[model samples]
Target: MLTRLTPTPPARAPVLPTMGLMLVLPITASGGSLGELKGMSLEELADLQVSIVSKRPERLADSAAAVYVLTEEDIRRSGYTSIPALLRLVPGFSVARMDSAEWAITARGFNGRFANKLLVMIDGRSVYTPLFSGVFWESFDTLLEDIERIEVIRGPGASSWGANAVNGVVNVITKHAGRTEGTLVSGYAGDRERGLAGRQGGAIGETGYLRLYAKHEDRLPQKGLADGSDKDDLSGDRVGFRGDWDLTPADNLSLWGDLFSVDSHDPWIDGSDLMLQWEHARDSGAGDTLRISHDRFEMETATSTDDASIREDLDTFEVEYRHRFAPVRRHDLNLGLGYRWYRSLIEGSEVRAADPAERSFELFSAFVQDEIALVPDRWYLTLGTKLEHNDFTGFEIQPSLRARWNPRPDSTLWAAISRAARTPSRGEYDLVGVSTVVAASPDTQWMPLIARFTGEDRMNSERLIAYELGYRWRPAPVLGIDLALFHNDYDQLRTLEYSDLRLELDPSPRWILSVTPDNLLKGRTYGLDLVVDWRPGASWRLQAWYSLMGMDLNPVSGSTDPEGVALAGRYPRQQAGLRVGVDPRHDLELDLYLRFVDQLPDFDVDAYGELDARLAWRLDPRLTLALVGRNLLSPSHLEYGVETLGSTPHEIAREILLRVEFTY
Candidate 1:
């Protein structure tokens, strides 16, 4: 069993407006600006609404899963410049810096450069790559101010999000165009970061709004372990626009698009991405929504040696439709259908190449969920299932059941059982690479030997059965605590197996060794997560979290792989974080954060603690200044990596950033 902790209200409450207008409107008593909402009471904040679990708006306290919501206030007060850095605030999430532009992030366990089990989406656009089943975190960016909230689910979300959501899900929802009706300019400069950004928005007509934004940034290189040298510098720019319109009282439509490009050194890389999306919604007793999107991404990379190069072009188109309604008084029903088409063109050096070079696939899925109100909200049962078909995996199914019991108005308990799967990726099917070269066996005379790795066509999907339980309690109006535990059983995991070895007498006399991928690994993982939020008063707030995890992996019958088993438990066994926010004056705010991560024994990484601080001053309603210091506990340190991937690991250094913003 695995466990996850989520901050939820102790009792069922009325759903609030998605814009958070109800929570912010009351703050006008102090000031008429958004900043006044910082003093909202804990009770009011707990009543905030969320929709990640069931795809229907509901009070956070009523949610049954281990969910966490990061509001815009949290993002601004944290003073984090990147989305990956902000994720460190979430409990049960492991975030590590692999290099200047790469991150190793995962939930529960199985942390690595390609954390394939997690699913990530930005405003309905899936960012996970089908080629490698991982995300390129550096390729995505957004104006932090334009973000509404980020909903993170620590446990399996396959019942609602489909395959690849075996570990967790991250949904980043941006603010509606109408909410950003203003002109804003922001700039930042630091030891490693320099950027300028601006956005212009206004009413298109009586019932419509539009916003356009652009940004450019340059990042200094990081230092390597051998010597301090500039090796991973990067520069990038992006432009985007969004529009929203209310065609009628019951109908609304939204359109948005973005284009971006980035250049990097070390293994010189040039990449570009273009995306477009359109969505429509109508309220006819129940809600009906439809969305369509298209995205194109291209990347080219070359090693410093110039002997190796790789180019990839990927294009995707997706469509989704969802409906929510009440078939009866006691049951709420939600159903959705989705389809996606993906095409990829890949070219690489002799060391690594794909069989066909060009490939395409399609995926179709449908999901349905029903929520039953047992005993009039005191007890509830939710059941959901997802069925999907893909070119690789003919058919797959994910199912889940959850039960919630509210014994008291200020306390709740929940339990869930779910099934999820991680389907094979393009790399697991057509990839071919050179493993290594070595001398022939003792039996042979003096002959060089070569080992080659190839993908298996009969590869099957990895499966997971997860069990979870959680409790949320508000001991006092000013304090809240959440605890969760989970256990997961995984099977049919991928592993390398020796296929055959033979003597070749072709052009040159040498021995050939062959290896292929197979489903030969099994594992079990369990963990506990705890979170606490305390609001001592109107002027101060504190948040803390702790997580513990353990994993045991074994090879099935006739299979042996000690290295794979060791790699399964490479993440930290214990992790914790603390954050404090204080308002010293009406115009000044201070924040301090502390984080501790246990050592990664498998990677020979020592445990480390870090401290970060931020101070901000509001010159006026339209102008603000802030200074932030990160990794302040040390001058420089390594957070992740033995460089399994070609690039060398670099140490993260202490740095300070100053930023200013103006709005009209």
Candidate 2:
């Protein structure tokens, strides 16, 4: 249900290489790159290969993880451009847009703009920021056309990815240079948003391919908090290049880089990243890979009156090596070693300052994973462990054990138990935050109080132990069902512990409340996800999904953080969605999506349901036009509040857009 569309291949003819080759080499062809399962029967869809589970291509029915794949067909038919908006397709993802440039996204529970438990990657490059151990969703500008697929693992992936993968891992894989050939141009027009994109690709020598692309977009401000307009106008531009070369029959090399500058607010946001990788695969199912990358970004943050207007410049350098091979008769093993260094420059306004404005840190990690084919084609067991060392936390260990059993050829059951961690951010260890004034209540706010968040050098990592079980079954040739259940226990969560109340005469005559960050919060969350796919006829496809989540958080004996008690209600308890796609004629397509979200009583957000419609007509083999509408159910509604800064709840407005795309 996550991917609503797939190419209607004639007579179920799928293009694929050998299993061994597909697992060892990064093939960019159309076979496994962007294809979905809409057109394929339930039986064929069950065997679709996905790699997010153990970093190797494995059949969907055999994987011991909760996974979702949004393919190229889904992106083109949905008429959604932003990555965060498209993530709504997944029932497990709790996505909320706070403004034109800010979003709160998470899996299961603990949803916030600064949600630190989800790890995100772009073509294997990490996008998680170390400043706060979260992602700035607005900074991602990858064009939807360039993406091959969005693979989402709804549970912990720390054994494959590193820290912050406690909740889930989202990897946005892009189309390799070979698949994006020729020239492409696209233009979009709407009342609230407009954008243009162009790309060109060509052959390099006899065995290499290269592509370059540029994109620009701008949006008018959204509806104001109290029935007026908020001053968050957004505009940005991005340029990127990708090149892949087949050095030899057994070796390949790739180099890619991008530069983006955004003028959303006064300070502007800018970033650049470059990476190089080499891979070699042998006939014996052995492969080796070496990768190196560098990234730089600059941004300014002024979220609240008490929060300082800080300008930050940061740089990251990383080097990694990975090898995969068969160690014994029935054991497949993967080994990896990695090192990363982060350096940053932080400058704050006169009201605030970072403890160490200029600082650098290093991280070292190693991991090993083994897959045992216990019953050849019927049962499998995978065990993995990751050991990492950081400056703040001396050492940490993450481990996972997963098992899958195929009771019948058409039914599979899997279970997993994993331990993952979320490391401390620089702000939690060295930054001194000032919360100037906070309202004790909404009515008659008196008493000037200052809340300062003090950082501690000795901070422990937030930890999680998760238990999950899943079942996948195809009752008929046309219908598929997937259900997953999970329970998570969390420890060492951040809590606000006040030292004492005192009078500070210097900055201003006010009562100073020293609130130090502590790990005195504990909680447990449980959830279930259900997805169903049905295709009655070749031209008609229908999908439905539902999600339920519950949270119970408590502060420890010596902690006094009321916000922790209120945090239990930040996310909805129930959500559901339905999607339909129709292609009555060869040249026309129609798609409809309807989604419902439960109310967040604690945050003052009401329940809302919305609809999205898209109609596309193929004028020619190389050109197409479409009309799209978003949030058609209502004029506007509030999805969430930027509660950290106590800003007015943001209202989302409806829009109608026209899109034109052409290829040459």
Candidate 3:
């Protein structure tokens, strides 16, 4: 029911905080005397490995990238239920709650519900939507206890992950079925949210394992600004199954799927998917993998018109194969090929429609990466590139070069340079005459003004050239520090420009301000992230981090655009956090998390501070109890606002929850 409370990372081992892994304090508790506590040992920290950076496992201390891990121990004590909420614990990530269910998450900069530069995966499956190359955080849910670890890379990952992996990459890896071979039930209820989940797992004849789970959640709405009315309520139900089989000592197979229905506003978002993966390993890490999957999602969303809605359906099919082997001594090589197909259908009220009504698209991609040990284990270099062809863009290329050096057994220094791109979304290539915005027409003496735009066929992909540097040091057994710095140059950013103006008499003489999306925006961003972990003794641990960032975006010479103020103010300039984990008596645990987020001038959202506290007690080996209080510093506060996906902005109320857990 609880983790151990002893042993700190030994000397000569610096804890990698990248929970963006910008920061993570791996403290766990279950009651013990002060004399019996200790931080993680140096040997343990050095042995920790992560797989997101290069698609293969490597020691966190030896990797050539700024990466971090959030182990299962961190999740159980955080008192967070959703993946998005748990992300707040990561050092460099910006996780803003737009409303009760909607969220805006990003790393480094550019935060929005539709932020396109970040790529996220669950069990090696991408959750990015082709509609906008962004994730719908509201619908991205899972059983938190099943997670093994979350690996986060805070910089460009295009080299190995392909297009749209410009800002960062997140991989949520779940535990193997064999590790969860038991019955578990967990449930919680609070003023703002409540949910229940249960799982049953068992073993197959000789070498197979299986698990099945079901869960449901309901969330009440936030109070509106004008009238303080209830809005933004959300609810969802989900069921999933997983099976793993070992056919032989060297061959394995896994199949998994999930079905879900989430409702918000007036319409319900529904989806289902299944994945099959088979692998055969010839030698240590030398192997071949084949994967195939199918996914479908359908939903109806409100249109600009007072009573109209846009109904859309999408189906996707993908297949991929990969091979990893040591081609030459001290050199590790990896190669992969992938193909995907998408079928999309859109229907709308008589007022508007998709340009082509129905469409089908294909995508083909391949990537290769190699790692070379310059000197046995003291220095290393890596190079990789990806080539992709898609319906929106004919072809795109991404490449990266990285190097790492162990200046001393106690310290590591690394650097990298990478090129990446974000291709156009379906709306940027196919939508036409859509009702986008409505405003007051001052020219018409305050009459209604409508804005509509058509997709531009000549639009180009947004691109980035990123440079980064990092260092890690373990000065003593009780202290560890990690730092990262980055600068990014962006080109061909998305822009909406004035195209035409029309006056329509049929709709009572209104003005129409027509526009088209373009690539007339370019800019640069730079930032630094720092994290520190310290353990004074076995029962006391503290973790802290701070981030500083700056953005300068300007319109190119040939574009008619809106003022660029909002563009630059979309993200915060500074963020800092502190977490304390304490186990005063064996079987009792206490955690305190405090944070400060700078203001977003673009949205007129002011800077704010908050706190979350969690207390847990172990009654016996099979049952545990916890009380969690969130946003405790204030009764309510607005986290984010303005012009990204939703119409209403509501203040998030303080919350308190009581949770219970049982296992057999």
Candidate 4:
């Protein structure tokens, strides 16, 4: 299962000769068709509201952050069955597939399977693992049709979300039980994926509603380097229930839970979670909320040769309370308190091992934020801070300041400065052993060389200071634009160093190289993101975005590592996407998307372009059928590699899927 980890030279970039013309033609063709289509107006889309910025609902155009919202209509039209694939529409996010079930997703930069800088949550429950500070996307099997929207914030969110929210935050919100009041049956089959789902919902009482759903999916393996070989396949099942009750005129109660199991070629995973929440509101823009949740996840993985196997089990419990009110004539305030407990166990026969097989930790946090209006309706400022205490990092403080100005009725300008941190994980503090083994010389008689990685107890948290500026402009009822720029400075980054080398002959003659982690790296990054949305006529909508990024890294005065410098350029420098939505008739809809990703020189990944299309026909108000084609421009291509897990990266091939939906 292991493969050599080495830096390869960059290959020639892929060519798409007509890509530029293809993008331009859509905008030009829409100029004369604006009044002919019957669809949502641009003004309605511009007024979409999001809640991730300050934990309070606000218009997306007025937020003081780089934010994007994927609405329910956008999700249905795009025909994406997974969250990771849906995120590709965001302007600054980096989404890549590693295998049949695993994905690497991040915002801005620092993209990897174990990307520790991003925080993800479903509703109010955190999904990031405490073991590695990353998410296992395969375990998130919620029904896509039940999702209401996804909010993406591409900047430091620690001031509100606490630690490990350095680069970004993603919040996936689902619809209320009351919104779905009937029976729904959905199924889809394709060259690569097949799944079936059913849901039943009804009124529980005069003021209560409940819904229950179950789903199962089987995914075919990915294409390998050689012909006819396939990577690991995946299958999984999930069941969930949700309930909502209006306890009184001003009080509400909500309960939800999910249970799931996944079986794959190399791993088996199972998990369950439950959540309860209550809220009380007053007419004067004041409210109090309480939430409590628990989650448990277990995984078992082994190699094909059966020489090594690993098992992991994790459980987490969390409680939170918050209140919001207007404290003064022109000022609003919000405060919250949270507590979490985590327990984990690991057992395995592998190259790396943890010293303490079972361990537990606790986290306590509190935060406060205030928004003040400088002018009646034109200018505003917000300030917030969070204090947290945890086992890995004793105590840490995060703060942010933001300002927004509305010079015109349809435009907004905003800026922000923030501080965030990435706390140490179990693997960074307790792991030790031979990470890899390789031949020391061409001759087999020579002793094999081993790279031994050892953890350090004195590790410090990685920190970042970020500055951001953004603007949103709506020139007419048919078009809108958004722009964002950011600069980040990093400190106390992690790097590996060789401490010792020796020959061991007790078991067998071999060379052991001792490697240790240190806080000896410093770096800076800057990037820009731009998005445009236009509706030429009532029948067509066009959306496009472009992003640019650059990074610089160096070792401290007393440290030196050439490899660390090369790793800094592991992300793409440029990326762009174009999407067109059209309705030729009242019952027919079509969507086309094109994307281009720049080369990753350090990872030996070449630049490439992708095309996806979808068409749907509404036979009646209660039934619909759709067809989707992905990666239509090429037969196969590679998106990423997983060197740390010693797994070979596979190729993504063209695929087609047909779906049928019925509701009553």
Candidate 5:
């Protein structure tokens, strides 16, 4: 298991002798700060906010993509204690807990241990691994409070983000140092879980600010076999710091870094990983910005049945520059260039029966986007492309075009077409020797395939062509709706093929082996997204969304895996969720949320629904109390499916968590 925690010297209380200066802090200005922000009308919010994921400054409601903005208020009101649970609210996204800490999250289809479609980032650092082409959700943990907002784009973003942005993009942004300028301490111990966190932030000078935080938690036990058997336990810790300086009124610089390590055991396996990252941003002349970052991640795992283990390490560096050009009235122009390099190494022990291997690669790209106003305030068109090159694949180009029509102040319609790609992971292009078997002759020995670089060098990138259409409307002060439709065509999918294996005897017999990464399957995916928000009154708020998806592969073709079998993508046809919040009085708040997911194929988990609710009372400005309930429909329900070779289908463990949160 892997966890996030902070490891630093004990926190010391801040000494503030200026009693009259307390009111000068922006943080102490009011109690309804976030609530007041959320109460703003759709039009008000639209004009006050800008999103970066769009590559151009656009109002949340005016953007052409199907996007969702999860604010800090949403996190505070959600009864769920974990980050994964928070993700369930996003339409088209499927999030399930595999164990105490592991999670499986994807968009559209083919979600698994190696979900190769989605792209995730924190600030601007990509979290996808080169070893498996997927993210280890468990290893990505942070102090939820530090998050400013999460921007989720539900369709292809390859034109701007490059390969692996085929399905969706999730960007998590953190608050600036100026927003956190006080001492905060929190500690909690609940049924099966215990944790403590501390933060200290203040101004270093008139123009400089810094914040540091550390946290640790213990995992609880889960029932296995549906018989209350304690089969698994999880735990972890994390620590990090962020700082920023104002070099001038128009120029600013920022630096952020963190270190995390996790270790645990009990379920079917145990594992540990260490992650570190550093990022810098600088503003130059005339609306120009530059960013550079570096990251290192390492993880290892051991199974209960064997002493063998698998180890993986990855290192990556990226640099980006953005220039914004000013022009007459409605004209906006932007240009950007980025470079990324990745290296990975994996080792497997004898018990794992897998191969050991090492691989490294680099990807480079430059992009440009320009926004033109057709009718000052009524129409706009945005166009962009990414010209990229990689070691495994030669030069590649991805382009996108979008047009937005805003006939009225509160309504918009948009359409776009884009291209995206997915490069092969180390597992797809490499192999390793697993075991040794004795026979009558040395030539007759048998060995398992481990992860190793094979000399064949035969692999191609998977590509996608996407089309999207969308509409947004705000007919009244309290009602808003957004809808989007998309279609995708996939090609050059990488599939493994069966090859002959040859063995030889010292005196007479001999055998040969064969393998190939051939083009096997073509896939198509189409879907619809609908989001509705209604604020019936100042005290009551409601939000709901529904997603319908359909995916298919040309299975009539031949086999692609070593078993010579065709595999179909697995995902539910429909997923829906609803959330309601009510402030009965100024001091009392209540929230209810419900999520429904259609059963996913390839796994036996049947369709299920989860209901969660929370009640809170503001005892005073400094203290609050909350009672939370999760999985209220069932004490425990099957949330995920797991399968092993030659074994029966089983469900992941599920239980209830009683959590209490306090802030001062």
Candidate 6:
């Protein structure tokens, strides 16, 4: 186990929306009603704190490119029992279950076990692993209620966020202590699932507030648990907490820390892990803010047949400051600086020991952005650039330009061009070793020495240049639609090829694993996203979204299926979802949701459709009854494939779950 903490200082206040006049309407048998008040104003809605593509806080109506926001209300209404489930509603994102303990999630394309292009953060703390430069979604469990909102930026964000933000960025922001200023507890049990969560927050004094939460859950086995399957153990439990405080009127401080652990007894392996993080922020006045954070994660796993155990540890520290200035009434200037430290250590079996050689590095970055209002409320232009220095790549620069035109109060068009990068992961370099195998025929011993190159010692990072355009329209007071299109050109893509090597066994085994990261892949991706929200009547609300994506990798000699490769085109080409709700005046609320994902290639597994539905009835403002169903159309489904020592590959299985929740 590993742990550490750094001192810091913090921050939230809310902007309330004015209430519209309520209408006394007629009711229908379907529990729906007519003549409802309109929705919140764009200003009040955009004030919810968003950092989708840029660090600056701009109204959603004024942003350029594609962005989707999942609010707390959205989470509560969806009735999802987990974070992965909630992500299914995000546009341009691919979320699929690989197994009971694994998930494949990414933006745009290249969705896989090591989806190295996208970046994810929890309350500003990056959760991506330095070992693989990918997120271990299984290890990132948290109380959904603690999350304030999730901002999904569906394009390159490397200009300000640094490397690994190649395709898009997901910023998961949590609620402030002041908002959760009360005691709440929730529990659920159904089918093969059971969970409990509790939270408490309130004003500590006239100027300070704090919030704390803890949660635990036992995951159910896959659909075929009775068959003694080797797919996944799937069973697990986790717990964690978060807190914040307001230090002064001009300066604020906050502290958040959590511990997570999971145990599995199936799939021939058992595993457990823990993670903790702390963050602080300060206001420097003059439209300036500063933030700092420290996070750590540790895990240990063992093979069922072998007593050997693999242990890995990761630690990261980050500091950033943002300054804002007004060049004119409608013009703005912004500058910022950030620093991050990433460290990792791995120990275990010989193969594991040779996997990731322990290492640590530092990153420093600075950025400047200007948002010039071409017109008081109808037009804007923005230009930004980020300069970064890292241990592997001494210096790198990323820049972007964007513009937005709002012809009417409810309609807008936007476009942008940006550059992003994906730095090398731990597995790409440092590891070196050999293995010995005994031949049964002649009792001969064969030892093979395999050396991994420290490519970063003299290598360049992967780069991407992207273009995007989008439109938003609210044709009527009760309806709105948003659409976006994008294109990306890649260079210096990390690629690997096998080297010819000879091996001898009783049967004369000749095949060898050849792998390396080369700047030999070129690819392009394009996509369109549309989301529509309508409130046809006072009691009825409907939401729908559709996505179409295309991805192709440049053909290389001797590679017959380069474009159809697992990571390149494994994401669904089409995805759509719908949500409907009816709230009657009698404190009774009913909501339903549906989702569809197109097929994709995965090793030996065939693509399949995933269906999920939810039903919730609010008993009162503080309590609710909900029935949730995941993959209700089937007991289990195969979404991904895994290769072992033999030629026959196995696929990971899906599961069904039902849960109930209550809050007070």
Pick by lDDT: which candidate is best? 2
lDDT of 4 at 381: 97
- Candidate 6: which stretches are off by over 4 Å? 1-49, 223-228, 234-241, 264-285, 304-309, 327-330, 432-459, 503-514, 555-566, 602-607, 643-661
Off by over 4 Å in 2: 1-41, 302-307, 438-447, 645-648
Model 4 misplacement above 4 A = 1-40, 226-228, 305-307, 440-445, 558-562
Q: For residues 415-468, could you state the per-residue lDDT of candidate 3 as single tens digits? A: 999999999988777766645365556655666767776778788999999999
* Cα RMSD, each candidate: 7.6, 7.2, 7.2, 10.4, 7.1, 8.3
lDDT of 1 at 101: 79
Model 6 over residues 1-664: C-alpha lDDT tens digits?
0112222222232221211200111100011111211233333454454666677676776678688888766776676667776787897688876555667788888777667898888776678877678877766667777777788888888876878888878888876666566555665655656667677666666655666666666665453323545444454455444555545444455666666666644222222222232323323324656777776677665454343445667778888887766465666777888898877786755444534457788999999888888886888898998899888767888899999998998888999999888887765665432232332343323344333223334447888899999998878877878899999888766665444544545344432334444566777888898888887765677888898988877745544333334455467888888887777554555666667777765553455555555565544333344566666665566664442111112243333344333333
Q: Which of 1 and 3 is the better model by lDDT?
A: 3
The per-residue C-alpha lDDT of model 2 at residue 94 equals 90
- Pairs of residues clashing in candidate 1: 1-486, 1-487, 2-485, 2-486, 2-487, 3-485, 3-486, 9-61
- For 1-664, candidate 4 gives per-residue lDDT tens digits of 1111122212222343533632322110010112322445667766777778888767777899999888877777787878889988888788878778878889877777778899999996889987778888888668887887889899999999999898999999987887666666666778999887878777776778888999888889998765657658899999999988888877888999999999876568999999999988877768888999999999887565443566779999999998898458888898999999999887765564667878899999999999999996799999999899999879999999999999998999999999999898887887766744678576635888877777787888999999999999999878989999999999998777665568888677888888777789989989999999999876789999999999898888766444667756667899999999998987788999999988878778788899999987665444456789999999988887645533567888889998754455
TM-score of each model, in listed order: 0.91, 0.92, 0.92, 0.92, 0.85, 0.83
Q: Candidate 3: which stretches are off by over 4 Å?
A: 1-43, 303-307, 350-352, 433-447, 506-508, 536-538, 563-565
Q: Which ten residues in a row have the lowest lDDT in candidate 2?
A: 1-10
lDDT leaderboard ranking = 2, 4, 3, 1, 5, 6
- TM-score of model 1 (CA atoms): 0.91
Off-target runs (Cα >4 Å) in candidate 5 are 1-40, 187-189, 225-231, 264-286, 304-307, 328-330, 349-356, 433-456, 499-518, 560-569, 643-664
For model 4, give the 10-residue run with minimal summed lDDT.
Answer: 25-34
lDDT assessment of candidate 4: 0.81
Q: Each prediction's Cα lDDT score?
A: 0.78, 0.81, 0.80, 0.81, 0.67, 0.64
**Which model is ahead, 5 or 6, in terms of TM-score?**
5
